[model samples]
Target: MCDLMPAAQPAEKIGKMKKLRRTLSESFSRIGDCQGSDSLIKPLDTIPEDRKVQRTQSGFDPFEKPAGQVKRVHSENNACINAKSSSSGKESPKLRRHSSPSSPTSPKFGKADSYEKLEKLGEGSYATVYKGKSKVNGKLVALKVIRLQEEEGTPFTAIREASLLKGLKHTNIVLLHDIIHTKETLTLVFEYVHTDLCQYMDKHPGGLHPDNVRLFLFQLLRGLSYTHQRYILHRDLKPQNLLISDTGELKLADFGLARAKSVPSHTYSNEVVTLWYRPPDVLLGSTDYSTCLDMWGVGCIFVEMIQGVAAFPGMKDIQDQLERIFLVLGTPSEETWPGVHSLPHFKPDRFTVYSPKKLRQAWNKLGYVDHAEELASRFLQCFPKNRLSAQAALHHEYFSHLPPRLWELPDMSSIFTVPSIKLQPESGDSIQVCSKSKATSNSKH
Candidate 1:
């Protein structure tokens, strides 16, 4: 009877082993049943009865193997699990889904508390300019705070301006010190410049001093040349965008409309540059432009600096602007501009055939300085290709009187650093004061 009892216990043990194996196979079947389970997981009937009794007494999981054999069993189980997960339809519900890398980390070196805004300098369509002082080093800065749109986030203009300014390091280009980004706003920190050319001109209106004009134009060209050499075009070049330091250092600013030109030129938007400073070619509905597009604006600014008034201050539309330009530079024809007839806006009968007037006649102040009219003519060419390049204009006879070393200075060095080169005082008072005096004199007469 004792021997029969032993035999009955073996049958009972085998039945328990079969039940454990079936449970394991059913649990892993969802993960494409572990292929090695048949060999790795053994029935208790195969183990020595004494060892089985010891494992059961130890309270170890029935499905787990000894510690020494545990690693291999888990590895085989993982292989089948991974295979099932790789199939689109067989993904395990227990699999964890990891997220992608987060957006670009915030600037490590710059923070909002680094600068304190003192006063509001100005406001524009998308941003507000404030005069700021650095909390870390006690230096002044111009903080341009651009509001982020709920739907759009950061404006492309701000991104474009920052990316371009980061690579451009020169005495004539505005320096971008740091950028502070937040959930509600994006702030661009810049070296604080006292005033811009437009405000400076308003302070002393009857034309800037010839020496001052020369200095400003030189700096403008210097900056333009640097950008042009790198295939960049400052699509907008107005007096308001040119910042003037207290020491008369002219730095180009507001590059929101600027873009890099490729080797094979592509058509660009024609609706750039203020009407008063826009070039004839662009005003004539021409989209294919180059660095010359900016040269025309440079010429207009040059004339305005010498004359104290916009060269073509059109009060109306594109036609009025073109008419103002034609009145001075004469209406263009195939003889003057080989492609004039092909321009979208050009119509022979639509424009008056006015003979070209000498630049000195239109802006008498150009006649006040030697070589000034000639340089003005070179820039105000009716044909886009005929305009002088910023680099070439820098070497023109109009700038010949400047110190020879001005041409040889390093890219980041200011021309003011040259000995004896300084800003000359203006001869006239502010425009308002001059206007009041003129009105009083006329009333007395």
Candidate 2:
């Protein structure tokens, strides 16, 4: 929203602080509320399908097409998650993984005793992650322990997480370290990140300074841009999925809900992202989706970063979620969104005629201008096709206008101030980096 520049004088700093506080107060007050319904039950994400695979006689897996600079397939049947650098084999840890004996993807049997579980990081419906240390090289890793259900072999989501991860490599994405399999359970080892963006925000409370927000948003778009180029949809892009290390680098994580896009058809699942970050097209039941799915999420995350609250925190109901969104952005019509009426779930009675509102009005209400207004306009587009692409967003005027010093430092040196740093935008001085060595370290990030 506001640029948090470190002014030279205390009086200037106080004035800036006053301006920021006033802006926040007025923005929250200025919003026009649309009425919402009370409902507490909705599936925020997709349930795993048995994911029937149409395996070719050539043993060519549909999920293994890796594009870009480099691609690696850990195994045909056993896809793995590894840090991108680790994918190059130079950084990949030497380890064995547990696997289903009967599966053709199974490798020669390996022992799971090579790693020691330290503590639990978090748990989800399909898997639980632990802080683990590898005995082979004493490297710390986040071990994702997936529970094997009786009826289903391994959930398709886990397969997607492992396989898709092994093939792709990028700095802003979480690194897959090792996949250790035992007869009873399967463990996915990832390059450990100390905390996620959600926790980072919690530590900062109120909200991060605008400069940091810009840095983070830039990294996020950069990462998403890479994924979209690879033709994979993250599907989920909430704060919890963005990982941050001690040196202040951002990485995208949690591919369990992610899926690769298909040519000719894009229909996947209506239920994919966390309800708060789910895009309007998905909410309206348009399964023929594309990278716009993630762009919409980037918009929600942008708003959350600016305001320190969810843009649309619909608890459980799809209707409630839409209510929160349309309340602020206004309801969409076929006129605003072409072929919107053709969505499978679109019904004549579902929406009432509501006039559109300018996103700038809200930004003005918050006293933000320029890039925030422009980027917000691009990201919050009602029609999915109209949303800005991640690659384009990175080069948007908002980011282009920034001074060189702002993005280079591992951390913003001071309230947006840099010491003895002067480089031209054309100087070819680029500074986006990830410390693979320290990514998994717990050393005071």
Candidate 3:
């Protein structure tokens, strides 16, 4: 009986063990079937048993790996962990690696506390001028503030001016000291001249003496020669643009129309110089003109200074201007200007009878010359090529017997030496006077 009881117990133990094993195998099979047949089950079952065990040991949810292991898995995963840690912890968001707004590359003007704005000087098509002083340096400078919002072309004009001025060092040209660019404005800091040739001539009233004219013209030619040597052309050369220092020195100002002449394939339009000072070639529709254009302006200025009025002031329209020119210089024929017949607007047969005696009488009437015949003969040349160059005109016998030092004009020391001159508001009275002179000069031309 004892032997039979031991055998039965063994049989019972084997049956229980087999049933337990069968139950686990069926559960695993069911789990595999659910995972293979359903996407949800597959995703949920992706977690490895070891990772689940680690999560459980670390008190983390078993659906995800432990935080440390997940962070170590990939750079993006690590970044996510760090972000979460920073957010939950007492740390602020990480700063990005970017350039600071206050870096030196940013544009800023004179220290706000130092520069004091003075009165407005002049307003042009693109900018306004003011006279300001630096409290820090106690220096007076012409402050040209450009309205970036209103200017149409590329801001590179200012950049080019600054860059060009940086390389140029000349006494006869305006000096640029500093450049300031803000988000909305561009400022050019320059050495200011107290007066321009037009203003000085106005103040003098009777017009410059022949000797004074010689000196001014000499300096003008010298400045132009220097500019031309540097491959720069002052496209706009007029009396108003020529700044005269209190010391009697002449310095060319307003480089907005200046350009480096070395560029290839360049052909400038004829409308650059003011109409009164424009050359005939320009009027005839020539674009590939050279330094000779500037010579024509110098000639006009020469005559104006001598006569106290514009030499060749034209009419309102091109036809009127042409008539005025022919009336003064006499109708240009193929004899005087070989190429005049071939000009784009040539009208040789449309001659207006020129009375040389009447023109001479008019020159005398205007008090333009003591010897009207000699002066008129020299000045009334019709062709631009026949006109005198600035340098050649400087050496003319007109200045031969003048004082040894022709440059010694009154208050000569103050001419261009002013560090800064405050720009005053233009009085309507002064403008009227200037306009009147301009008109009279045009009629005479």
Decide which is better by lDDT, 1 or 3: 1
lDDT of 2 by residue, 1-445 (tens): 1111121354654565455444422221101111111122121121111221111111111222222211111111112222221222221133333333465543222234545566544444455555655544455556666665656645556666776676666667776655544333556666666666665554454445666677788878877776777777888787767876554567788787676643223436677776667788887877777788889889988877666555676544667667667766778777888987887766758766566667645433224635676687788887888888887887787777566654453421321235432221221222222234322221101
TM-score of 1: 0.72
For candidate 1, what is the lDDT? Answer: 0.65
The superposed Cα distance between candidate 3 and the true structure at residue 277, in angstroms, equals: 1.1
Q: After superposition, how far is residue 306 of candidate 3 from its true place, in Å?
A: 2.0
Better of 1 and 2 by TM-score: 1
- Tens digits of lDDT, candidate 3, 1-445: 0000011244554565455344322221100000011111111011222221110111211222223333111111000001111122121112111223355543123222224565455444445566555433444556566556544422444544554565565666666654443434555666655656665555444446555665676678767766666666666676766776545667776665555543331345455665666666666656555666777677667666655566665535555556666777677777777777776666656657563434445344234444333433454456656655544554566555544443343322322334432223222322113343332321210
Per-candidate RMSD, Å: 32.1, 20.6, 36.6
TM-scores across all candidates?
0.72, 0.66, 0.60
The residue-level lDDT of candidate 1 at 227 comes to 87
Question: How should the candidates be ordered by TM-score, best one leading?
Answer: 1, 2, 3
Best by lDDT: 1
Could you arrange the candidates by lDDT from highest to lowest? 1, 2, 3
The true-versus-predicted C-alpha distance at residue 81 of model 1, in Å, is 56
